[model samples]
Target: MTCTLENHRAELASLLKPVFDSLGTQWLPVTSEQLCDRITSEDTFAVLPIPAFTNSQMDGYAVRSADLLSAAPDAPVSLPLGFTAAAGDPQLELQPGTASPVMTGAMIPAGADTVIPVEESATGTFPELVRCGHGTPSGQAAFTAPSPEGRFIRPAGVDLAAGALVAPAGTRLAPAMIAALASSGLTEIPVRRALKVALCTTGDELSNGQLAEGQIPDANSPMLAALLRRHQVEVRTIQLPDDPQGFVAAIDELQAEVDLIVTVGGISAGAYEVVRQALSPLGGNFHHVAIQPGGPQGYAQLGDATVLCFPGNPVSALLSAELFLVPLLREFNGLPEPRPGHYPLAAEASSPEHKHQVRRALIRDGQVTILDPGSHLVHDLARADALVHIPVGVTQLVAGQSIETWSMNV
Candidate 1:
């Protein structure tokens, strides 16, 4: 039966849910540098506090708050400065009645409860060192204002405490999260293994190189491969001829090795529709989906693997992957679903009465300008950064009318 685009997605979800669940989880150990965009397979904990130790948040003086209590603009108090504490310096104890020069991120010495930024000091910078009676370099730091306790100090565990949850299971690690995890002394992380897919593009007229007369260079294979790779899916490309028997043989050989098999081309009602011809006898459901550019869609189960078939046109295959396949793939991979954004139309547009028209468009200046609506317009598709969705029964759209768009660059 012909299904609407929404119904097709729901059906695909229901059919593939078990196949994905049966695949189970495989975890890999990865370093913080390799963790970006990887989904956490298990709960991760902080090995140490984020700061690990109290540190100065500014290049200034670390002093006891009581020492600055009497200092004011009219009655500035000067105290001898002790050792300089730069980042990576060993922690030391602050002597009474003396201020310690501490750089930003420097460990705050014991007994110091406040930091006075160098800019706020009387000299507006660190004082020069001189020899003192004890043979240690010393300098004077004058404060004109009292510093409250803990001012400009990043206390231990202020950002994250020891043994705290760093990232929970199913969390997609971004760069900032990786930084936090690395700062907590985590050297290795557990991330879910990438989903494995076999990308098959079938058509006798398609060639990868040196196309002869009546043959076209295969765009669907590479295009779909890139889309799959963007989602971190491990894809193995298989180019099949229009011969149905040969197609079945190729699929049978790879079905056991992959979690899902995605085929582009040869799924329509044409005479050479190898994908539909080969898989339909094996219980594949091939039907038209109520969507422009991509109407012919099919799915079948081949033993442990599930198959998803798209039309032959480049634009149709691309939109099919974006709308139907990518979302489900992201869902199973623990990634967030791509949310649709609404933008005003830059110009007037129209759609058919029965099928949702998914037109390529350029979104700029908060407006979406629809491009050529033809399914064969690969050049136009290349220039598009978004897909503007005009639903069924909406025949016309006026300029400045807000419409839903899905970013193609995502």
Candidate 2:
């Protein structure tokens, strides 16, 4: 039956709590090579990293750090150049009393401990007969100091200690996550199975989408389907007419197959409110919610499944979905209720009673502003980038107040 806003929210929360709490998630072990879809339980796959030592961080001479402490720009120290280590080679040990020219990312030789940038010393004119250098020229050793060599070469495991939490259970893996996971030696993970949903649209006129002789097209059902899908919900659809018995039979038939049932229209006090009438026979009652253009919302058990009913108007249908369905999705998926975010109101507007108002608005200059006239203009809701929630009792919103909006594509 219809109830206060608070009651409806409470009812919804209760019905949804078990879905999140008892999801009883399962995992199927699969090879890392098989990981594909973004929603798989991240724990199901593990990766085995292909490890190899590679290129340098930069090019410079590698030496022992203790060797450079006394060297200065004025009276520089000098040593014989040993074999050069290029970017990708294995470590090249320095001969006794010699410095090795090394590229970035190269492994340090067993004996060398540091690197000094090339800018610190001059190449000193190429000599046909190179001098046997030690602690600077022996004659110059009396005058020159030694330069430090330890700062340049990065020690092994500096960037990553072994066995890190690259991608733990429940991780949402991306390229970087994959790289990290592979690096940490994993190949598979276990994840939760997806929940299945079915959409049953009521009213023949709405389905036809033909505006003939006061008839209306069925916009709400399809729109609702799209919204659910955007949230990664598994959904399918069926349509019904304005006959209570037939609709009830259909609900009876489908309840065993889906986790939830959502219907659009025919919940109001009107005579042809077949969805309400149909659900009423199966443990539910159709009643008016104390809200707005969509106040005529309904809910009840449709056999084993809970049915969320929305007003027939397109805006009302979508608004109802936003207010009720999205939150349920979050709970069912074992995720926290989304934090409500806000942007400035585009323009000031007023509504009747203590109803929560939703209007068409887009994000402009980092703020939410009205996109169209503040009309209950049902169709206009489709154009909205966000929903501006007017709080209870205010009855009016002055422009520029940073009202809360639940993003549409979230």
Candidate 3:
């Protein structure tokens, strides 16, 4: 009997519950330098405020806003230079009626609440040297304009404050997050443990090399392996014979090592389906799903491991992974949920009457265009950046009609 695609997905998820639950608190420490692409397991806080102190945002003079309140284009104010401050210079108080030259990122001196850019002064450039030895420069710097208080000053804690929540739990660490963590004085991160998966391909007619007249090369195992490994899931590929005993042995060997077992092929109604024949007694519920190119799907519990079964066709196996297995694995690892989008079809397409059909598509300029070589043909899938979903009961999709699409980028 055929099950709705959603029901089948939920059933498969239920079978893998134990593995998914184990990942909630399972975490490991990753240093900031190695945090890229890792999924955070807990919220991280800033130890210190970003910038830590008010600083100058421009290479100019630090002055009190009151000093330049009356300064204008026709009547500019002139003040004796108090000192010159480059980035990292020790903080010094600004003497009254005097201005200090401060470079970008230099701490704003006490008693100063504004910055006058060097170009806005009569000097038209930064001072070559600053005398902080109680003697002022011979010529005074004229501020030709007036700016509001706090202008060009980066106040303390403006970007981030101490103890601020920076990265919340379950965030995938990217370059920006890593930089934020580092700037917040964090050196290490707690990240979810990488998932481990076992890949097994079953068939008597499968080969890795040049095929004899009736033999087909095994494409499912390698494709699934790459897809899983790309997401940091550890994958071990197992070759299973058409013999039921061999298939059982292979699964038994990998039972203790992997969190989940994904098998491609031999679960359909055909007589030579070795996976179903061997594991049927173990409670594997082989059934068809209301989805085209990936209708035949099943899952079963063997001892402590969960085995997810996909159909023999390359497109079906890969599409099953993208549509069902990968999403579950991503959720199990604390990754954000996938958000499929809807786009207008660039051309007309047909859908199966009862099953949800997925066409490999390219989304360009807000429209989705289907690719050729169809479902059984595997090579053209590489060029597709997305999968356009045509739901059950929808017979045809006219050009310019909008349909849901799943991105294959991740």
Candidate 4:
């Protein structure tokens, strides 16, 4: 059936829907270790902590704040040194009428209520011993300054109780996420498997050997394969000669193995449109959509597998893949919605008729700046960092009117 571009996109999406929905339960569930091969997400992960009692905010005397209540500069309280504590050292418990020397992060032992700064103590000097001299307030300090219970200590489970969903699902496992996952004791991730797709771009014109008249080297097959793998699709590519019997025989051998099949060319109206003709025997259709570069696109079915066919022109082939193939791959992979960047509209190409105008562009400052890869000039596509879609006829982008664009991950 002939489909308008929008209708085709909808149909394409609909066609692949069941493939995902009916994905049978895996015979063997995948583990995190197995996912290292294909799982790739850019999602943020939560923090994984290594437990420790951190140092106090400053170097100070460990005492009950109350002991220092009456301790002013002139009559600075001098608590006898009961014990001393430093970061990463043993907790020091102080006795009544005395204080312990403590550094930042030292554990507060039993009977200590608060930490008074060393500055508040007679020994305000740092890097020195806790000097509790003979006349120091060894006997009076505890009675004067006291702190409330649990003042400076971070009680266990205060931040996050263990087993409290430390690592939530849907987080893109990254390096930091690796820590969280490791902390969660997950050595392997359970993720969707890499989709396997097969490709066979057909044309009599394509060859690596010396070219004859009207023949051009095949760029679409290799290029498409490269493009597919870049976005994480595990692709198997085959180049077929233009002969109808040869193509049909090739497909007959491929259908049972692939989940999806994408053909590069020969689905157009021309006499040599072998794919449209040969696949018609096995069910494939090539018809015009309301799209320019990808006007002649098609789809077909071979038993359990489906084929998405694109025009021979590299631009057309790529554009068709972007619009049709990407959504399908994403659906198959169970990935989040594709994130597209935007560039400013550079060229003055606008369609007042309001049909989706798919153009090439470079994304800059979160906008898609337009650049037309003149329908015939497929090479121009190489210069583009993104693809901008000026959807259907709202003509005239006066140098900088914001238009929605679909940015590819090129």
Give the per-residue lDDT digits (tens) of candidate 4, residues 320-375. 88788776665555446756544455546665353556777777666556676466
Give candidate 3's root-mean-square deviation (CA, Å).
Answer: 4.3
* lDDT string, candidate 1, 292-362, tens digits: 98999999987876998988899998999988888887887667766788999999988899998899999
**TM-scores of all predicted structures:** 0.86, 0.67, 0.79, 0.65
Off by over 4 Å in 3: 24-39, 64-83, 88-98, 130-140, 144-149, 172-175, 204-217, 229-232, 240-243, 330-352, 361-374, 393-410
For 1-410, candidate 2 gives per-residue lDDT tens digits of 44776678778778766554544454433345433333434433223222324224556666766666666667566777666676556666666556666667776666876666665545532222212232322211111345444566566545555543444455554556556555555544454555556777777675355477756766666778888875556688888767888888787787788777788778878788898777776677667676665788777864477777877777777777877777767544444555667777767777655565555667878777755433347556666677665556667777888777667645
RMSD of candidates 1 onward, in order? 3.5, 7.2, 4.3, 7.1
The regions of model 2 sitting more than 4 angstroms off are 24-56, 59-112, 117-160, 166-187, 207-218, 240-257, 302-304, 330-348, 360-379, 391-410
Listed per model in order, the count of residue pairs whose N, CA or C atoms clash below 3 Å is: 0, 29, 0, 35
Ranking by lDDT: 1, 3, 4, 2
lDDT for 37 in candidate 4 is: 28
Q: lDDT of model 4 at residue 105?
A: 70
lDDT score of residue 387 within candidate 3: 81
- CA lDDT for candidate 3: 0.82
TM-score, candidate number 4: 0.65
What is the number of residue pairs that collide in model 4? 35
lDDT for each of the candidates?
0.86, 0.63, 0.82, 0.64
Candidate 1 positional error at 184, Å: 2.4
True-vs-predicted CA distance for residue 44, candidate 4, Å: 16
Greater lDDT among 1 and 2 belongs to: 1
- Tens-digit lDDT track of model 3 for 1-410: 89998898888777777786676444443453435677778898998789778999998899888888888878989988878877887897998888988999999999999998888787698665574664655557888788789999999889999999989987888778787887787766777766778889988788888888889888888899999876668788877889998888888888888888898999988889998999898888898898988888888889977899999798888989987888777775555676789899999888778988888899899999987635687877877888877788988779998878878855
Deviation (Å) of 168 in candidate 1? 2.2
